[model samples]
Target: MGRNRKWIQICILLAVVILGGWTIASSVLDKTEIPKVGSKAPEFTLTGLDGKTHQLSDYKGKTVVVNFWATYCPPCREEMPDIQKQAAKWADKDVVVLGVNVAESKVTAKNFVDQLGVTFPILLDSKDKIRREYGVLNYPTTVFVKPDGKIAVIKEGLMDEAYLDRTIASVAAAGNGNK
Candidate 1:
């Protein structure tokens, strides 16, 4: 009986260790496994407020800014104007700003955009499918894609006009490098 009890304890301890190791490994992998800066940005197709579907692949050869935001998020609301301004700054260039609204209704997103006077395309991610694909866990996450479809940067949180301009400039510089 004593030997049996000891064996059972050993088995339980081994199971705990194995489970703990797997949990830790998975979390570490998630943290370090974000999309690479120079790798191809993940492609997604979502409908905009105008009822037109927009695909990332469609914007190939154009520098695209994919910003994942929600209408109710304060930081997301704050950064919308800056994103709009930055997009306008590069209007003549081959650049497009896409604002992806995560898990928000079209009516809400449309109202918010109209209220803010946003001129850029606002894509709807009603189910948050695209948001999950982009690994955007925070509000106002911005992913800058270079003209070659490669990712230039992924910024998480509220972005000011200066930061957005700097990031756009970096993408432009990266685009020049590819040429």
Candidate 2:
């Protein structure tokens, strides 16, 4: 009886270890699953402030700039104007910058847009589905998608004009091949 009980205890311990290992491993794998430099950018559909439906797939064959932001993020506020300018600068280049408002109300986002004078489409992620789909954890995160819908760059934090220009140019110039 003693040996049987000991074997059962051992089995329980082994099960616990396996479960723990699986938990840790799955979390690590999930973290790595966030789209990388060469991965296919995840597709999403969200409504824009223009009362139009915008889907990432809709912009295929054009270089896309998916900018995740909120009105309250200071760096986002700082970089807003530059994004607006770049959108205009690169419009003829077949590049489009999409401002994905991170769960902000239309009133608040519209206020910021009005103040900043940005003409780009402001897609509202009211439920933050788009942000979570892209694994965006921070404000001012920019996902530069290549013409073929693969990610060219994933930049987090404020971006100056130079960084935006360089990244957009690189992605626009780079085809569906390696980044």
Candidate 3:
């Protein structure tokens, strides 16, 4: 009986070790790390509301603002005008703003943008692929990609006009140095 008990304990201990190792390995392998500053932003191809396909690689020489938002998010809605203003402000400066609507239908996104008078191209993430790729679990997340195809900043909340202006300027400056 004592030997049988010892063998059972050993088997349980071995099982625990194996399971623990598997858990750690799986977490390390499947971890979704947010793009770090100076890392290349994850590339994605999404269809904009205008029925045009927009790909990150297509805007190679431009600084890109990739903002992930949902129509139901109040902060995201509040920042639309400022984002539109920023898009216009940098239009001539080789900057592009890409608003990605998270898991929302085209009509919903279009209606919200139209109501806010936002003119920037809005992409539809029907499957939430881009949102997961960028590790954006919150609304109003903005990722700034410099002209060199590197991420400059990852902001996860509402951005005021001043913050947007300064962020764009900083990215522009970084791009200038790279050029």
TM-score of each: 0.80, 0.80, 0.82
- Per-residue CA lDDT of model 1 for 71-91, tens digit only, reads 889999998888888889988
- Candidate 2 lDDT at 145 equals 89
How does each model score on lDDT?
Answer: 0.89, 0.91, 0.93
Residues 102-153, model 2: lDDT tens digits: 8889999999999999999999999988788789998989999898888889
Which parts of model 3 are misplaced by more than 4 Å? 1-32
Residue 156, model 2: lDDT of: 97
**Model 2 TM-score?**
0.80
Order of all candidates by lDDT, from best down to worst? Answer: 3, 2, 1
Q: Residue 118 deviation, candidate 3, in Å? A: 0.9
Best by lDDT: 3
Worst 10 residues of 1 by lDDT: 29-38
Predicted candidate 3 versus true structure: per-residue lDDT over 43-144, tens digit per residue: 999999999999999999899999999988999999989999999998999999999999988899999999999999999999999898888888889999
